[model samples]
Target chain A: IAGITQAPTSQILAAGRRMTLRCTQDMRHNAMYWYRQDLGLGLRLIHYSNTAGTTGKGEVPDGYSVSRANTDDFPLTLASAVPSQTSVYFCASSDSLRGDTEAFFGQGTRLTVV
Target chain B: SQQGEEDPQALSIQEGENATMNCSYKTSINNLQWYRQNSGRGLVHLILIRSNEREKHSGRLRVTLDTSKKSSSLLITASRAADTASYFCATDNFRGGGADGLTFGKGTHLIIQP
Candidate 1:
């Protein structure tokens, strides 16, 4: 099983454009997350889903949106891309919300907003 | 913006030596996790330690958590060239199901010398 798959391994977008990053996991994990990693900065959560049909905002949710339409899919969308939005995005999933639950991550999508 | 902070932004160690990285968080957490990331890739889960546990080990990797001090340490023994990567510590916020995302640290860049 492909644990987690992120589409368009890398992309280049112009400023003020709209872009969607796709993420899918075969594990059917209950929780899914979207995070962006910037140079010299930690991976900051952009949005998350506790389960299918439920979505929530994380620390840095501004300028981004997410939807958990089904157990296998959780996509992140950028409304108006800017240089600040240029970063590597990762999708992760976990079995449960309990303590010490291990998270599995995707390969990542490198987006360059010019 | 960032929940965890890692010490020694960069480290250089001989191939057979050990590498230790420390992380500190400001809030109470259910679990602390360590992840590894190559230069421009998704972070891979390494290990996790619960608040009630002081130490845990996996193969050549050892992790220690001190809830009283809200900190954790990750030790990798007998490092190899393949171990050259950035290490990050992530935390599960105490606020239950809503905090579905994991907050990560800036990360420690470990370089293994051949």
Candidate 2:
């Protein structure tokens, strides 16, 4: 009950439409991240926030944006959905950005762009 | 860019046997982690081994890290039907600054034949 939660377990969106995937964690973690998992490609980091009010791009940040208004939430937004963006998006968080820390992940949001 | 690459990509083992998956990374890392993802769910942290550490164990899971080789392996003993899932290795790059998120490798899909 006290972990990361992602909304709209699955969604189908048309290309060129705007969509935002919601992610919230109750762990009070300092680092929150968004990743897209595609077949054969694994999970690629899209964006990450180390703390409130600051965010950084990760390996694949194109066409996606994230905002960390506070420590509890990190939402990923796709400005214009593309068929290529159809994949499972995951939200994760860690106590800190330290390499030794383990991350907690939320049930992924399966987004399919038509 | 993907920093880690998991070998085999797919593995199959009989229940009660052991399953081993290997991962190799390109850059120096502060730590390595293993995670398991079920059919259509989020990833769960399995174990974490620091750069200075060689091997770590948690219950039936064993993780080995070799900084010199930039490789790590995950071994699950006494595998069960529930152990059938995709296992991934993630690395935390050793960049002086720690704002970056973990870099994940394409996972190894393991099937446990009961």
Candidate 3:
């Protein structure tokens, strides 16, 4: 089974354009997260949802928004993409919010905003 | 600034040599986890060490947590060429009845040369 699937493995978006990164997991996880991976900056959390219908801003959520309509889907949207937004986006999920529980990640989405 | 920082941004060693990566964080955490990422791919969880625990092992991986020093280390024994990848340390600050709290380090790129 595909534990997690992310759409549009790679994307090139122009500055000021709107873009959405879609993530879905079949594990029926209770917690999901969106993080951006940048060189020398590590993975910065953009948004997270502990469960369906609840969302919280992460460390770098200024230009991103996320919605969790169901248990399987959590999408990250950039209202206006910018050059600085170019980075690899990863979607991860965990069975629960337990401290010792591990997270499963999907193949990242490589987005380049020019 | 990111909460976690990994030392030796890049590491290279012979295939039979052991590789060690260190991670330091700024705040109290529920647990510290190690993850590996291949080039142009997503991250895979390697191991997790709780704040209350001192050490853990999985296969060839040996992870040590020193909460008093706010640091952790991962050791890979008998490294192989296939062990070449970027390794990251993530800190979870989750507390009961709250949103998930996590942060990641810039990661150490380890290269196991044949």
TM-score of each: 0.96, 0.97, 0.97
Q: What is the interface RMSD of each candidate, in Å?
A: 1.5, 1.2, 1.5
lDDT of 2: 0.92
Per-residue lDDT tens digits of candidate 2, residues A71-95? 9999999999999999999999998
**Structural similarity of chain A in candidate 2, as TM-score:** 0.96
Candidate 1's DockQ: 0.76
B22 in model 1: Cα distance from truth in Å? 0.6
lDDT of 2 by residue, B21-106 (tens): 99999998888999999999999999999989999999999899988889999999999999999999999874755457889999
Assess chain B of each prediction and give its TM-score. Answer: 0.95, 0.96, 0.96
Candidate with the larger DockQ of 1 and 3 = 1
A15-52 per-residue lDDT for model 1 (tens digits): 99999999999997889999888888888888889888
User: Which runs in model 2 stand beyond 4 Å of their true positions?
Assistant: A97-99, B94-96
Q: Across residues B1-114, which tens digit of lDDT does each residue of candidate 3 receive?
A: 588899989999999999999999999998999999999999999998989999999999999999999999999999999999999999988877654746999999999999
Report residue B40 deviation for candidate 3 (angstroms): 0.4
In model 1, where do residues sit more than 4 Å from their true spots?
Answer: A97-99
| lDDT for position A104 in model 1 | 91
Can you write out model 1's per-residue Cα lDDT over B1-114, one digit (the tens) per residue? 788999989999999999999999999998899999887777788998888899999999999999989999999999999999999999987576444778899999999999
